[model samples]
Target chain A: MTPYDYRDLDPLIHSRIRLSILAILTSVEDAEFTYLRDQIKTTDGNLGAHLRKLEEAGYVRVSKSFVGRRPVTRYRTTEMGRGAFRDYVGRLEWILHSRPMDADQREAG
Target chain B: MSEANARQQAGDDLAVIRRLMEDARETVSNNGWHLVLWGSVLAVAEVFDYWAESGTLPVSPRVVWSTALGLGWGISIPLRRWSRKHAAVDSLANRILAAIWIGCGLGLMLLGFCGARTGTLPGPVTPGVMAIVIGTAFFASSSLCDRALFRMLAISWWALGSTMLIWPHPANNLVMSAGMVLFMAGPGFLLTRRAGKPARMELVA
Candidate 1:
């Protein structure tokens, strides 16, 4: 068996969509709203809802505007979010490692 | 029952799922400089073009350009908000960018306001001092962030301020252009490229 810390283990981070969101945020300095939407394949409301969750947690920040009459949006991760994610990944790896065989396994027929 | 319970209770598979999600998320995120860069480039170009075509001197030019930047800032907020739903704004990096966008937008607004009034703002010193002040603000803010790409952008602002204050180029916009190109766009383009390379790698791998 393995021991792990799950205090801030936001189940929000576990969702396939949100997890992907966090993952993408970790790689670059910042990203755009449209860029994230196209890659994740979720509807406008769906992605927005998840992002709002992240924002509430102080995991991400949002910025918006326009260029030549066209609108623009950008996103970036917070230091807290970054640190939390790294730790989450670390805990996940630790959790997945197989433990020593149980006594019953030694006697399997 | 003992062995089965032990294995099932561990729920190790959940961990695997999380890791996979992280990998997949990063593997997919990015829109490159296509949207924001093009917008910024066009906006800046428009301001430069107005200067070139009209040669209207102080009043109209600053008013027009500043108004334009103000509009740009207002527009960027919604654009950014909309993109979040699409997939681009779903990540951590992009979230931090929110503050940057706000800062830049506000800075542009301030610059625009100042520029609009600078003609009456008394001597060229006001404009120069304003440039230095705004430039210093951007430089300092960028410095506080740890990201290399951000630092590059800070240098660009610093260059613009220094050039205006010390070198005082009346005839050459090239110096400013070079500042954006070398410090802002150059590094931004490179970083965008750097970020995308990995997303493409899985396909090759």
Candidate 2:
């Protein structure tokens, strides 16, 4: 059995809201602020807080522009963010997949 | 948190993330009315041109085509506006698909105009060129989405286009008409029908 390491999980991407934002951004080119809020089912303030964290970590790029008279903010995952997401998800998958084997070994011992 | 409980929570979070990704991917679905509209219009125009060219119709082939083009524009302009207005969310895939078809449409129109001005477009090969243009768009769209059916449709179009190159003028139009109904309009209607239903999201394995 391989050793399980929780320390490998990224602290920045470990939270639910941040993970949700990354996951949603991964599947699309870019998404509007309202769209992300609606998809994540969070209050605007909360979504903004999480997005700010991600933006600080350089995991997302936020662009502000106007469509006619309305100002729009859109978020997209950066290349660095995509790499981090892949690694984060990969580690999570390994941990989840290895748990049953570790449990069986403990029982056999 | 205890180690075991923490591990369990991590697993749960991962599942939630996967589900969220799946749902996000499924949120944008195209109804494909544009495909049906253009396919039907083109098919009708081809058949009408054949009739006019074969001396069975009193009107010039140019008049028939002009009428078809005018009607196509009339319908397409409003429909596109309505679609943009009603769309719940715009995704990258939708934008790319629109660009592919619109670019192809403009390219074909330019080619046709050039050919007509130079008198280089023989009647027999018109369907062939149209088929190639439509096939290019289908191939591009199918590749973008990894849709096997549309890939097959693309191949079918190439084959139909090849047949058009060899077939005589009126007969080639008949072939194009049948091909449009069988390959183009048929799939379009199916896509529109499917889009009307609730999408069943499949989790990535």
Candidate 3:
């Protein structure tokens, strides 16, 4: 109903791709770069960019290792990211449920 | 934004989270090769031990078990390395599952070899102790993965172990062998079958 009510929603996690990435990471302990790309149905470059944004925000942690000769990258959500996601979801729920009350108040006023 | 648009966006976001979480759980739970391999090996070893105990086989029980356990470890170590190298994802559930089973294996080795040789654990009651340890592992695994099948197996192992401990008869060897085949190998085969079906369908597609 007002900008103040939506202030708690994280802009970084508001985008569809970033939201999807967080959702996937929250579900599993860790996931490989290729796994996330395939699940999100995005190109490597696009996925990598979103991942980097989240990494810079300290919302995700990446680990690099070698499986024989080939290098592998894995990602997981950090504690801060988990907390932010929870707050975002809680705020979203509040917004969804409080809209009717706000509408009723506006009509009365 | 309009109320209708905001509501739609919220619904879509929640749906995406729900669907992806379910998919991740399904993918992580599909692994069953280690269970199948270990179950088959243990089942065969228990059966051979039963035969030797019954005088149906002339070989010593000690020799049969040692060779069987040795062979199991020899194969399992390499197999685990290969699986870890090839795994597409490393989940917390998988790690906990591996740790539970690895700890179970070490407990069995200590009870079977060290405890027995040192006379700290009597030879006759060793199987019962091992069974209890296996049951505990299965219980832990069931709790971790939320699988009813593992809980049932845990109960079965506990019952078998209790029965052997109470009776303490020579014929319990045959009973233990039967328990291994029915409980361990049977579930292993079922898990392997379920895990393989998706791969086969993918190949066909």
Model 2 accuracy (lDDT, Cα) = 0.77
**Chain A fold similarity by TM-score, each prediction:** 0.79, 0.85, 0.84
Q: By DockQ, highest first, what's the ranking?
A: 3, 2, 1
- Put down candidate 3 lDDT per residue, A1-109, tens digits, no spaces: 3522344479898877788788778878888898777777777898899999999999999999998899999999999988988887776765566667776676578
Which portions of model 2 show Cα errors greater than 4 Å?
A1-21, A30-87, A90-109, B1-31, B199-205
Tens digits of lDDT, candidate 3, B43-78: 788778778878899998789888988888898889
C-alpha RMSD by candidate, in order: 10.5, 6.0, 4.9
For residues B1-205, could you state the per-residue lDDT of candidate 2 as single tens digits?
4456656866887877877776666554463788788889878977887888898888987788778778877887788777754554456787787788788877877776677667798777878888888888889988555368789999999988877776746578878888878887888887777655542332221
Point out the worst 10-residue segment of candidate 1 chain B by lDDT.
Answer: B196-205
Residue range A1-109, candidate 2, lDDT tens digits: 3235455579898778898899989988778887777767778898899999999999999988766677778889999999999999887776666656775685588
How much is B113 displaced in model 2, in angstroms?
2.9
Candidate 2 backbone collisions, by pair: none
| Residue A92, candidate 2: alpha-carbon lDDT | 76
Per prediction, fnat is 0.10, 0.38, 0.40
TM-score winner between candidates 1 and 2: 2
lDDT of 1 at B91: 41
Rank candidates by lDDT, best first.
2, 3, 1
